[model samples]
Every structure is written in C-alpha cells, then in structure tokens.
Target: MNGIPNELTIERRMAVPRDAVWRAWTEHATEWFCPLPWKAPEVEMDLRPGGISRVRMVGPEGEEMNLTGVILEVVPGERVVSTDAIAPGWVPQTAFMISVTEFIADGDGTLYRASARHWTDEARQQHEAMGFHEGWGKVAEQLEAVARRIA
Candidate 1:
C-alpha cells in the first residue's frame, strides 16, 4: 500500500483552473463520476479528514455499487485521500483501495492525478484487467467537461 507496485493511476491535463476541477471533483461528482450507460445518481463528499466520502453507482440493469469511505486527508484545492477501511468515528470495515487525487496548477489549466493504491497485488491486477485506463480516462474527460461548464 506504500508503493507503485500495487497501484493504478489516471493522470490528465484539463484545460481549466485547479479550483474548477476541485469543484467538479467535490461538488459535481455525481454528474461525471461514472461512465455513460451507468450513472452515479447518489454522491456525497464531506471532504475533510475523517469525513465521509461516498458514492452509489447504478447500472443500466439496476445493479448497484455503493462505496462509502472515510477521507484520510485533504488539502483544499489540492489533494484528497480516502479509503474504505474505516467508517465514521474510527469504526473498522473491510479495506479495499485507497484513492489519492490531486490537482496541480499548470500554465493555463490543471494537472489532475488520480491513483488507487490497493492492499494486494491481485487487486491492482484485477483493476487493470477491468479497464482502469479506459474507464478512468472517460471519467476524467467527463469531469473536465463539468468543470468547464461551471468555471
């Protein structure tokens, strides 16, 4: 969980300001979190350390995936790290991947970095096989569009 040995990342250069991207990430996630034909209809982001970071995705056939996690760290307009290992008030839960997202200022836009660190190598491999690059790339594109609209 400490190295790139078990991780998947999606980095993009968005043609928008860092704050705009941050807002798209935190405020308008439901509008862009999931790939099309699937939807994140319910999303909640309490972006402080120990706050709840949650999302519920519904597929075209009514399948559902709910991720309710705790925010482990946050730097306003810069970064956030969250994991599903613990619930609120330090309660324990099954651990999966820990996600770290950052926004850095570029010349005229923001550099967005989103990485998922898994507890096991198998998990990383599974994620890759599940099309992490294509899925996350599409989501990032959606996020950029949302940011542009609200900027």
Candidate 2:
C-alpha cells in the first residue's frame, strides 16, 4: 500500500510464527489488545468484510473506551483492515481512522506491521499526541508475549 500523508505506521519483529501471531490476534485479542492497567474485557469480531469489530477497553479505575468498526478486509494470517468510519450493515459513524495490521513470515518468526490512516492530518497529530506509539508499542509487546505463550 502506498504511504498516505496522514498515516501512522509501526512495526515489530517477533519470535513467533505468523500463524501463532495471527491466532493470538484473533483468538486471544482481549488478553493483549490494550496496554497494561487498561484491559479489554469485551471484544467481538465477525472476521469478514463488512462485519463488525468491537472492543471495550476498561481502565484500572473503571473508565471505559468503546470502539466499534467494520472490517474492510481480512487475509487470514496475513492482513486485516478495518475502519471506524462505518459500522456493520454499512451504517455511518463519526469518522476517525482506518487500521491495518499485517503479519508476515520472517525466518522462523513473524514481522508485524500496524498502521492507522486518519481522516485528516490533525487527527493523525492528535493520535500521536495521545501516545499512539507508546501505547500501541506496549500492546505489540504484550501481543508477542501472549503469542509466545500460546505458540
């Protein structure tokens, strides 16, 4: 995919096979989807185009953040693309960003890439200011740990 001016990209290399990584992602998502102190207690994924992908992140203090989106693409152990611009059944929502997560074979492990394509440069900047890298990086590390355990 061509780089978009309003996109934020992050990648990591994990000592886990692509299938293991994908399994951890799709099956054990709630265990590692959020950074520590903020857990995802609710997660639902239809795993198909136009299907719903939802998560409710709960902070240690009981604060909650809800995310509801529609899956735009899914490539099994390879890639997933989703967006908050639309909900299931093609319902429109307040547009935020599109997220893409990719898993690639790398030696005996996997290369993981995650990106967010914001609707505007301002939105991208806001995401950065909200600790996107640090937060998402933590999630990736947690994901790797979960994958290792499940692998």
Candidate 3:
C-alpha cells in the first residue's frame, strides 16, 4: 500500500518461516513484543476480530506502558489488525493508532511489515518523537530471534 499521511511503518525480512513467525506473533508475543531491557511481562492475545489484545511493558528503570486494545481483523497466519479505538465489547475509547501487521511467505522465510496508522498527523509525530524507529525496530529484531529459535 502507498503511504498515508498519518502512517508509520516498519518492514523486515526474517529468516524464519512464516509459521514460526506467526507463532512468535500470536502465541509467544511476550517473548519479543517489547525491546530488550524493556520486557513485555504480560501479553493477552486472542487472534480474532473483536478479541482482546493487551501487552504490559516494563522498562529497565521500571517505567511501565500498558497497551490494551481489541483485534479488529485476523487472517490466520497472514495478517492481523488491532486498535485502541474501542475497548472490549465495542465500547468507544480515545484512539491513537491502528496497528496492521502482516506476514507473508518469502522463500524459506517471511516478509513482515507492521504499520501504525494514526488518526492525526500530530499523533504520528508524537509516536515518532517517542523513538518509534529505535523501539519498534528492536522489537521486530527480537521477534525474529524468537522465531529463529523455534524454526
């Protein structure tokens, strides 16, 4: 897809197969969801539309960030879209971004892309200023490592 004014993306090619990457994403998210030294101690994922998707991250200094969202779409091992636009049971909430994560088979590995689409340019800028590149890139590398281990 072409660029949207309020979207930020990360694209990575993993040496692990699609199934392994999918497992790393859905079944073992806490293993790689957050960057090292900043662990996702708890993760709750139900890979279905409207299902709960939660992650609790704790940094080296004990700074915490809890993300609670609902899965908005799922395509088995291929794709997942989640957002904080609404809470469980479709309740309205203040939304910052919608995350779209996709994994596709490429040779013996996977082509992965994750995009964060914000409702406003200001929100997108906020995410970027918050170290989106360094943070999310580390997490993606973390996911690749976890997947490689089980591959």
Candidate 4:
C-alpha cells in the first residue's frame, strides 16, 4: 500500500493551466472521468479531507461501475488523494485502491499524474489486465479537452 510494487501510475502533459485542469477534475469530473463510449452520469465530490468522492460510470450498453470513496487529502489546484478503504466518518470498507491525482504547473500548462495504489499485487495485476493504461489515458485525454474548452 506504500510502494510502487503494488501501484500503477499514468501521466499526461496537458495544454491547459493547472487551475483549469484542477477545475476539470473537481468541477467537471463526470464529463471526463470515464473513457469514451462510457459516461459518468453521476459524480459527487466534496473536495476536502474525509469528504465523499463518489462516481457512477455507465457504459454504452448500460453497464455500470460505482465507486464510493473518502477523500484523504486535498490541495487545491495541486493534489487530491482518495481511497475506497474508508468512507465518510472514517468508516472502513472493502478497499480496491487508493487514487492519487496531482496537477502540477508546467510552463503555462499543467502536468497531470494519476496513480492507483492497490492493496495487493493481485489487485494491481487485475487492474493492469483490465486496461488501466488505456482507460486512464483516454480519460486524461478527455480531461484535457474539457479543461481546454473551459479555460
């Protein structure tokens, strides 16, 4: 849970300001959180420590994946860390992974890094096999487009 062995990370150099990127993530999450053909119809983020971060993604054929987690950290326009290991009020839940997203200033744009920290090697492997890179990469692209549009 603390090292790279059980984690998967992806990064993208966005063509938008860091604040815009952060807004795309925090305010327009549902618009770009999922890969194309899959939409996030519902997303609720409190954007503070111990707050709720929930998203429900719906696929083209109506497939759904709901993720409800607790925000562990939040540095406005900089970083956010959330985990399914716990819910609001510090309630424990069956954890899948801890998600860390960073928005770093890069010249006039932003550098986005998103990491998924699994609880075990098996979980990490499962996520990778499930197209973590492709999925996350697509989402990043979508996020950049949204940020650029709203910038």
Runs of candidate 1 with Cα error greater than 4 angstroms are 1-3
For every model shown, what is its TM-score relative to the native structure? 0.95, 0.97, 0.96, 0.96
Better of 1 and 2 by TM-score: 2
Off by over 4 Å in 2: none
Task: Rank candidates, TM-score, best first.
Answer: 2, 3, 4, 1
Over the full model, what C-alpha lDDT does candidate 4 score relative to the true structure?
A: 0.92
Model 1 error, position 78 (Å): 0.4
Q: Which residue pairs does candidate 4 place in steric collision? A: none
Global lDDT of each candidate: 0.91, 0.94, 0.91, 0.92
Q: Could you tell me the lDDT of residue 150 within candidate 3? A: 83
Ten contiguous residues minimizing lDDT sum, candidate 1: 1-10
Best prediction by lDDT:
2
Answer with 1 or 4, whichever has the higher TM-score: 4
Clashing pairs in 2: none
Show the lowest summed lDDT stretch of 10 residues, model 4.
1-10
Better of 1 and 2 by lDDT: 2
- Highest-TM-score candidate: 2
Give the distance in Å from residue 142's predicted Cα in candidate 1 to where it truly belongs. Answer: 0.3
Q: For all candidates, what are the clash counts? A: 0, 0, 0, 0
Candidate 1 vs candidate 3: which has greater TM-score?
3
> Clashing residue pairs, candidate 1?
none
In model 3, the worst 10-residue window by lDDT is 1-10
